[model samples]
Target: MKAALVNRKMGLFLALAGILALAVAWWVEHVLHIMPCELCLVERWPWRILILIGVVDILLPGAAGGPVLWLAVPVLLTSIGLAACHVGVEWQWWPSPLPGCHAPHISGHTMAERLASMPLLPSKPCDAPTYLIPDLPISMSMMGGLYAAGILVAFCVWKYRVAHTARRIFY
Candidate 1:
């Protein structure tokens, strides 16, 4: 097959994978009521950006060929880093800096006010990781790790195809 055709195919696949990841995240958060901490939300942003990049790449194949891969590599790395950080936080290897999400403090108020504000506190502590599938013990942040793996795999496959195509054309 032609290099252009192969590139298009890979771009489509990446876009589809990204879309599926986003849908799953939404389902876990909205439909299943698995609330995400601030860090979890931060970890998700890269996936969202990657999905957007994939979509744009698919729509404009010429723009995606080489330049987009350069863009994707760093984004994928950043996502993996963020996911690792979240895992560290969940395991208590490191503490999260975000307030309200990572640390809960008693409001400065009288006893009556504290009693009235009891319901405002989150039921789940920020330190606690929320899992989409509780039986697996894998939190959404860890799931982001899975997504990063997919992105890396996609990147490798795409790179291989590009290199293979270039070799065929030149030699």
Candidate 2:
């Protein structure tokens, strides 16, 4: 029972994390007027899935929900991987996997014509790194990688303790 309660709490934490990340992204886009690159947009999908999973875990019974929060472990690790790839792109370590990472040069088109063709809010190229904190060497992607890794480790440690306690109590 304690394990289940802890798991549910962790689920809520993961959900809040997802929401908070998304909220930051939204603020960056809408208020700050910063555009997210293709890879940046791709990185958000897992968080959306995590949010759904977290909510479900919070609502469901212990038998069904205990295992659900565990999914966040891999989901967060994969997010770390995605952010790492973005960092690599920013560093020019390798070519971007997504072609949309580079903006195509359009020429010979009239100004009005180009405006009609372009997206309302242009996506920032993946090669261009956005630094949320000024004067800090850390890019947003690097920060995301660190954040995910930290959360992953913390979640795993918390899970281990809960499992250890449950095992001792039950057996």
Model number with the top lDDT: 2
Off by over 4 Å in 1: 63-65, 111-124, 133-135
lDDT of 2: 0.84
- Tell me each candidate's TM-score: 0.80, 0.88
Per-residue lDDT tens digits of candidate 1, residues 1-171?
365566566667666666777788788878988776777667767767777677666666664553564566777788888888888888988777666554445564699876766556364445688776648998777778877887787788768877887899899
Write the residue-wise lDDT of candidate 2 on 47-160 in tens digits: 897798789888983987887887887899899999999999999999789987777645547998766766665567899999989899899889888888887888889888
Candidate 2 at residue 25, lDDT? Answer: 85
Colliding residue pairs in candidate 2: none
Residue pairs with colliding backbones in model 1 are none
Error of 2 at 32 (Å): 1.2
Per-candidate Cα lDDT values, in order, are: 0.72, 0.84
